[model samples]
Target: MADYVIKTNQLSKIYSKNKVVNSVNMHVERGKIYGLLGKNGAGKTTTMCMLLNLTYPSSGEIFLFGKNPKKHSDEIYSKIGSIIETPGFYENLTAYENLKIISKIRGDFDPYTINSVLKMVNLDQHGSKQFKDFSLGMKQRLGIAAAIMHSPELLILDEPINGLDPFGIKEIRDLLKRLSREFGITILISSHILSEIENIADVIGFMDDGVLIEEISKEDLHDRLNKFVEFEVSDIDLALNIFKVLELKENEDFTVSGSTIYLYTHLSLRDKFNALFVNAGIDVGKVNLCEENLEEFFTRFVSNN
Candidate 1:
């Protein structure tokens, strides 16, 4: 099989002349969690829908397991499990009964597998509880149980932790990590919870206004938002003159805000910079190292794009 578990090329979805997903190319590598992040109406769900073949793309192609989805949809989808939006279950039925129905529909009914998945998601103890009486977290866990009971090679979850408490969220996070690490399942998860995604995802795809603006690995993204030195000088005008004299490229090398200058490079030459200012008859107040976290970086990226 190809290296990518999921791949899309120039995928587009349009309705009544409005482009919901526009020329989006995405890649989800084997055995890695790819976080699809965006605000509402940013086309995250639509993109997932197209990938799952729930919604036909207006143009372009989708590949699952290295084959075109249109040509191998049945074989491909059978190997993938997904929970998009709220999953439906018989409210009056117990958790076990609900999964039993799903097992029949899946046509690979295995009682032992069902029980194993329920235990995996921490729903085994609550299997006798009626779905109607289950808490939101319990219901979500059941949904996960149903999705994984068949042991699919790939999983696509849209906001799986929506109604979860902090503890529930951590439980699900650890479960996903375990699934990926132990079973070698590739996951494509979409969430507005950037921090959770930052913590769990191996790669991140940022979307905005129906466009895939950037797809970057978590490590590379962190490096791009690395720490920089911020200098608070006494004279703004004289600082600019000094920078010009030193052939420093404005904005490229540093940014100015009132009396503060943010330096993006030459971090190791901090003493040299200070000496230059001292020799140039400029007064430097404070110099501090600063860094932007993922959320701040995402905001800046969205605003810029």
Candidate 2:
């Protein structure tokens, strides 16, 4: 089992009469990507703010590296790096200079760290050009370079792929995955990009209206999201009779599409089911599992919520 680098218990934040984040209990395991997903105005950014100590929660507790930030020394916070909203940069300064300024604040400026992080985020080419001259995607990459300049153990990024094109998005995604896999940095990434999360997240936490509705591993989600095994049989009446003898739970939950009968189970009961049909003078055409994509699966949760 992986150690939890960060954990929250019943965390919440309210503004006047409305709750922006309500009872959001989530965890980020060490060296793993935990994708915090939600719709717009669904409290993902607010929850991330509470985690980073940029915004105070109305009630509840949060632990970073197994200690409360409120009670711990400032040294404890130095291990974290975050890019909550748009990362501010000196438009007059080049990417390297911007990172140099950040490194100076921590009193650990080095050419090696700057070069290493720039290469990690694929921003090594932006040397002398000022920040204003960089494209939106280039700026985002430079922002990430700044975040990791100090070699922090935890990195929290919200909407990290907001402005990037497909190639840029892929580059950022691969960099994040490598960060977790190679450097052992824990990541808490908040984004509505389900496909992006699906590609990298080891664990996924779904937030709805400020509340965490579900938390599941990518492997477990695959089992659940593999909706049903469909079979097309030539005889409907014979198939229905065999289904009755199989004693499937909640018969109404199963559906038939033309000649195909969808059975919602991981185990393939086709051999047994087919034999029963064949003995009963029915022909079975095909049997296959029908799995929904990540977006469709997420929509099912949101609609049900």
Candidate 3:
């Protein structure tokens, strides 16, 4: 069996009469980046909270590092770090001062440790600046630095780049990659931004309306993204008939939805297919050879269920 840093079975949560999070089975391997993605209110945060024991699960089990967290909360927390929503600090405190307080609160740290985490996050030079004077991205870095002060084995972050500019997003992305590559820290991060997740995640799990829909590795996702030809016709049934006469296999070669037919094979024959449709009195509203990109693929995947 693979060594999993975090695992859940039938994990669920209910608020009042509404089920906010349904039975969810999640697997996050050790020393890998796992991106949990969904729209706001998809219960991504709820699930993470349950894993951290901030919120109790209504059903199911959670295992962190192959042991029940409930049985070892002290041992579990010592090795896990997290930032949910915005990380807070005294506005007037300098970056070093804020982290110093965090270190003091934790009751364990050498003076050298503060600078190490800050340097790892690229905030080492900004020590003199107060938290209020720092940029959004800088604040995030400090949050991360605080989370990593003890050098935990696992880091859970929720929307770390939500409002960051492109440059800031890139900064955080690079930092996370470095942590995963250099330190071998397993990370479970949640975000609604599809492009950022695609750029950094080794594996992705998508949730919709509190249900975890699917989880796939980045390689499998790329393999499944096929370039195809899209045909918008006046009639889907007639288009299917024309496809049959042309000896095109159903599903294997083409799929129909409403007035649209997508051909996954023989993409080079788009012109010939258009001619055949026109010859059969089928109104070809538009025929364009199209390729599915990541955004479109994600939308189609999550919305289908």
Top lDDT model: 3
Range of the 10 consecutive residues with the lowest summed lDDT in candidate 2: 245-254
- For candidate 2, the lDDT comes to 0.85
Give residue 181's error in model 1 in angstroms.
0.7
lDDT of 1 at 217: 96
Give the clashing residue pairs of candidate 2, or none.
none
TM-scores, each model vs. reference: 0.83, 0.83, 0.84
Clashes of 1: 0
TM-score of candidate 3 to 2 decimals: 0.84
Which digits, one per residue and each the tens of the lDDT, describe model 1 over residues 90-185?
Answer: 989988889889999878788888888888888888756889998887777788788788889999999998778998888889989989999899
Question: Tens digits of per-residue lDDT for model 3 on 77-183?
Answer: 89998999899999999888888898888898567998888889999898778899999999999999999899999999999999999999999999999999999
Whole-model lDDT per candidate: 0.88, 0.85, 0.91
Error at 148, model 3, angstroms: 0.7
Tell me the RMSD of model 1 versus the true structure: 3.7
Q: Count the backbone clashes (under 3 Å) in each candidate.
A: 0, 0, 0
Task: Give the Å shift of residue 70 in candidate 1.
Answer: 1.8
Highest-scoring model, TM-score: 3
Q: What does the lDDT come to for candidate 3?
A: 0.91
